[model samples]
Target: MFDVAGLWHGFQIAATPVNLMWGLIGCALGTAVGVLPGLGPAATIALLLPISMKMGSPVTAIILMSGIFYGAMYGGSTTSILLKIPGEAASVVTCIDGYEMAKSGRAGAALGVAAIGSFIAGTIGLIGLTMMAPPLAEAALKFGPSEYFSLTVLGLLLATYLTGESALKGLTMAIVGLILGCMGLDPLSGAVRFDFGVADLQSNLDFVTLAMGLFGVGEILYSLEKSGTASILTTRIENVFPKLADLTRSGWSMVRGSVIGFLVGILPGGGAVLSSLISYAVEKKASKHPEEFGHGAIEGVAGPESANNAAASSSFIPLLTLGIPGNASTAMIFAALLIHGITPGPFLLKEHADVFWGVVASMYIGNVMLLILNLPLIGIWVQLLRVPYSFLAPLIMVLTLVGVYSVNNNVFDIWVMLVMGVFGYVARKLKFDLGPLLLAFVLGPIMERSLRQALLMSNGDGSVFFTRPISGSLMAIAIAFVLYNLWAARKKNRAARAVASSEAAK
Candidate 1:
């Protein structure tokens, strides 16, 4: 049975004037970051982390951060639609048809649909979280070290699926990230694995520093490599609202996207980026006029924007209930919970009902706040797209440095950021996606810890992995995925060779 009493209490806390104001501030700040190129939800959250700590309560602080997280997902699509510049990886799909819609003078309609879809999807995903989280938490309590090890393996496999091009490349990058994660202290034995006699690396690499380096600084370097400077769209703002017909067309698309996105977000290591891409692909395949996909499809903007927001909202479930963050933003949310002396996991709902439900209740309010904030301000966001790249690029670099250095007040972190930036630029030029690498880095430690624990528990018996039903099933699925990917690659290569042979014969 649903706990109506708990929900009412949550509303009492979340509806307070102070919390509401904090939520609004987060939403505004998140939107600003989303509108700016080279800034992402992770970077924004990290930059504001210190400031959030100054707030009185953990619940209040997290409510603000969560608002920023989901709001950024909503705001990211604005740039993709208006200027074809994706604010984040998740919004890339939006650029295909969203910019085309803008080109056809339907920018208003696109923005309106995206905002409305996000609002609806966010609300629905929250409801799912509320309904599903308690039972999930209960199940998590039964998880042993072996189960957790298997779960982490599943997460890495899912990440490979999300890597865009080649599974082999994704696997290689994931292994590299795992090795990087091993550069410091060995948790079980307390022995250094690959520190190479460096005292600074004794504590291991910081997640914030690596994330900032790879995502923030690396993105800036890649952006600088483009031939032309940042070109903001100068299209006149006309028709700032969607037509009734447009709404009718996009309503079901939003609903479908919301369902799909929420499910994907529940999976470990899968988040808004994957949800948005899947939503766009699904909508395009299902549309009556598939050819319209690359040229102003309303469904394109509506579906992906909705999916990304839903994914962002649903990602909180694992973080709050399982003490496992589904994505980077959720990882920060976990950090906030830890700062509050509130450890999240199976006991979280029992021990901190107020905090859990309060955060949930605040999500409802945050969605309403985002809708109010974004709809009328679409023009302002569009105008921001006009800012020149020369000015914006420098600001991004400075912010990246500040954010990285502020994490632990360490200069070494800054150097790490620069090196990662160079690596990111080179990887981008080589057509390798960064999504898998980032996922691998985030999950690496957890995977390593779990594997070691599982091994110890199994008395060093490798067969123990296949002894439990859940672990065995998960391993079976991973094996199937690998085999399927190999077969697909072989088929693709054969087809290419046949085409080349035909051309030669001709």
Candidate 2:
């Protein structure tokens, strides 16, 4: 379904020296941040959104941002292997076997396999994106307001289910986001709802305020609170390439991980974290010598690394095709496109073919660049962790200030950022998962508009959502999900009660 000629044209744009330079810079920066603990791609992208806007075209801006994203995916394993600390949630699984490998003098080999696996998975994801996104987008064009509304509802449901140990917490955070979304003027009546007499509230809170403050500033504050003693890795060896036997054994793991990651990432709330975990679980289950899993198993390193990178790449599909972000990072990407005066939807491919395909083409080049950089410059990425947190913290804070101020030179916005940062910090301590909240905040406005449009078209007929074929199907799925979760919760409660009863009888 993809336009071959248009894709080729996009490569012509992405292959240019200027764009390539941007990609390299983004990769370098992304790698640096990815090696550091407590910094993630979402926060990094939020921090860079201001700079991306200043770039000439939407295509160039997106190319640079995409580079940062996948680069982080490639770089995150460095800390996981060397420091026994994951650079992000997704790298947590890598820590189990990766660090073990490092401790056993295969650090270089583990890093090499990770880089190679990530490249293969990224390529697989890109192919899936190229083939699937166009068809999915074409299908989405037929959706009416009701269908779109159902789709958003399903997205929220899936997100809640996939994140955190508690569904209740995810639902609570989503509701919080919905409430915050209502703080601005009503889209339909133009009547102020929750402004509380603040002039900025009338215009509603801009996304940058929420994203930067919540993800960026809040993260820093939380990290500072828990700034434990650092541990340094003193063990290392020379060769960075994997043996032929390692590659032979890990080839299937990489292939399977890529497939799993691509599928998971397309789902709402599914990102590298979940994909890597699932991949590891699958590898363990399928391995004949599952006992070797936590003892420097090559499969352990290959699968999850591949899965993480693949997930990162495929997560872009929803945002690029249907204007729906599958995760927090893509939500930021969605916001970036909107800020650039380019609204993404089913029509995006037809309207902005250059930007869409250019970003895709750039991923191919970016993946290759990352693979090359990651292998030879592995030493450089490890050294980044040596920089003191004290030095980095102030720089990030200063950047946050500059970024918020650059938006409109508004002092009020800076205050808003600080306020939201506090809110986010408190929320994190309270055990609320910010993933659902941030995504819901971004999707909330779109959902409200679609629902209102549907009602208007149906003359206030609430049944319109349940009567339309596609919308009905989606509604059914959402209802089914609710029922399934309820059943699971109830079953767990019953099991706990039975155990208590047994203890009492004894």
TM-score of each: 0.91, 0.98
Write candidate 1's Cα lDDT for 1-506 as tens digits: 56678778889999999998888888877777787766778767765665666787888998888988988888898889877988776788999998998888888888889889999999999989888888898888888777777776777777766645767776777787787878788877898877668777888787666666776777778777664545766676667578999999999899989998999998865789888889999999999999988989999999999999889889888888877776667766776676677887889999999899999999999899889778987777666766777777788788778767766788888888799878877876787756566666756777888888888888888777778887887788878877887798899999999999999999
C-alpha lDDT values of all predictions:
0.81, 0.88
Error of 1 at 87 (Å): 2.7
Tens digits of lDDT, candidate 2, 5-65: 8779889989889888898887877777788888898899899988888888888888888
The lDDT leader among the candidates is: 2
Whole-model alpha-carbon lDDT for candidate 1: 0.81
Quote the lDDT for 402 in model 2. 96
